[model samples]
Target chain A: MISVTALTVSRGERLLFRDLSFHVASGEAVALTGANGAGKTSLLRTLAGFIRPDAGTVTFSAADPAEARAGHLHWLGHLDGLKTGRRAREELAFQARWAGADADGIAAAVDVLALEPLLDLEVRKLSAGQRRRLAFARVIAAPRPLWLLDEPFAPLDARWRAALGLMMQAHLDKGGAILAAVHDPLPVAARALDIGAGR
Target chain B: MILFRRELALAWSGGGGPLLACGFFLCLTVLIPLAAGGDPAGLRPIAGGVAWLALALSSILSLERLFERDLEDGALDLIALGPAPLELVVLAKAKAQWLAVGVPLALTAPVAAITLGLPPAQAPLVLLSALVGSLGFALTGALGAALALGSKRGGLLIAVVVLPLFIPPVVFGAGALERATNGLDPAPALAFLAAWVLFAAVVTPFAGAAAIRNAQG
Candidate 1:
């Protein structure tokens, strides 16, 4: 659904990547493999429209890139974006609503993530893995066409990693696309795009 | 609506939001009498000006973390991807700050004026000017906070960027109180203050949204 053509991104004086071109069609998952500081996250941020590329263009199939970034994609970055002072339920509800998800969608996400028992506790009290699951719940609650994940399974336990793999499979089966930045192999099969090799 | 509610709740729950500003304002009012020698005649004439100054400074107190917290915690990224335009999101944040902290500071302005020797009869003018002036502060403060995002010394950077923007509102607010103290019409100055606030309200969203986008990049 999205294509990048000769994309070049730089951070201050250093160039992260240059002349990089790739595409992800519907019902596909592409794993972005790279060494540290190899521009995987930068590429994701650029696609999500947070960072403007130094050169070249990234064009989407149907919607304008900006609109697509705003409405059609889910970006799960390193940070959970949960406020420590807020209850877990409040965070989830706010995120779900902010993403335009209905109450039924939130309930289904909660069920899939097994978030019921942890709903009442404050976010600060939850462990990192729980917080990560809570963060992932936002994606499930809101059905976006594209998923831009940065090390999506980094904080999850083995069981959750497997569960999240199933979710990704289901998402791809339903005509969704995924571009995940990762060091290890993804649980589900994906085309490996080696950013480090692109250098 | 959800964003506004979330910001309001966050402001009240942690970091002593409104209370901190009011306490600083009261402290400034109390210190003026102590520093300027406790004579009513001397303090009375300058009470409104001093109160306005304190209000402006107090408004700066809670602003350092306005957008910085969101940026640091990665909420800004999610916010960027939300359905609302970035300009509206910035406006919502400033509105939330106004409701959460500015309103309480406005409420405390009159008390601070009276403490600084302003006549109780003129307290309503102090309250009115402060209400409008604080809104201006919140808007300009959001711009400042957004601009100062990702900087090393964010708090100081916000004050440096915001205090200059605070000048016009301070002048208008203080002038309104000064006119009332002299028994002339205070409406003109209050109108000017409101107009300035409206201008800030209009400009801050666009400018602050740009700053937020830059910071995110």
Candidate 2:
């Protein structure tokens, strides 16, 4: 379970969000919604341990939802985080190896993502949508139980969107938790946590 | 090990820069004697300096790519969060850079020396000194690369940050070559180069890793 309590985040002299509290229990899917510049990405980044809040704390608890798991959260941001000048297959393999995923898991991720045909193509040569797919595949391949996805549906087509929704459902069925920031409505029964009013 | 291997593979697959740098080294080594005109003795005396300068130049050519693209794509952040410690990641990256740029230059030094009219016996010492010196170059370059990752003009920024650090290696490497070619013991210069490499190996990774972290943040 991920619990964020009395969180206050600021960039420079401006406060992006304050007094923000939320809990995503095991198997729960929570969508972060806000207008432009409403701190949705900041909230996700803070949850993923990539950003530090100006006040309060974010905790990941197995029981009380007030503890932190230093290594169990996976973050997939908007940039896609791909290494350029490398073939798609090689990049995936490298990421998997670095993440300590076994060979079988790597192969399964490639197959599920339908990345076979583009395996030998360098990442710089791949389309933006394809790069996003590759980044999504990396998240799926990670063994982390908590996922923080920022703009997860950006370049995905309708077919990929449905597939991703089903994938998230499967992940939730396995007792995993998700915190995603999306502009579009997610095709899941997730409680919306709007960050506009800093509630 | 995986990170090191991946870095190596990436450097190997990147085209143009690595090859052109090696070619430049070779061509420069050959051109020195031709330009000096009909004086084999003069060529021999300057072979060590020419070879070291060529190696340094080749290394600079490849340094710009070290962390630039990875930082842009967010791979550097992922690597920092991976299982390996940041220091080890920096070391692995330095090793890859050396393999791509330094190793090739070292391997071809003997051929370059031949063109420069350097004696066969002095060739190995020149190559060995270059290899050691280039390790330091790679480490220092990696730090500069990390520091310049997000700058507006990264290429020029890296060159500005790194050129000063190149002095110690260039001096010792060329000095070692000069001593070797002149039949004098090259131990002191070689020792200095080795010590520089050891010092760089110990300290450069931390600086590079910290720079990467700051850039990511």
Best by TM-score: 1
Per-residue lDDT tens digits of candidate 2, residues A58-86?
A: 77775322123335666778776677777
Best by DockQ: 1
- Residues B1-217 of candidate 2 have per-residue lDDT tens digits of 8888877877877776568778988878767777888688877777777777777766787787888878777777577657776788889999988888778878887778767777787777867887788788889888889889789888888889888888888899889777776778999998998998898899888998878766765
Deviating ranges (above 4 Å) for candidate 2:
A5-8, A12-14, A52-56, A62-71, A83-85, A120-127, B30-44
Q: How accurate locally is residue B199 in candidate 1, as Cα lDDT from 0 to 100? A: 94
B134-171: candidate 1 lDDT, tens digit per residue: 99999999999999999999999999999999999989
Give interface RMSD for all predictions: 0.8, 2.3
Query: If chain B of candidate 1 is superposed on the true chain B, what is its TM-score?
Result: 0.98
List the pairs of residues colliding in candidate 1: none
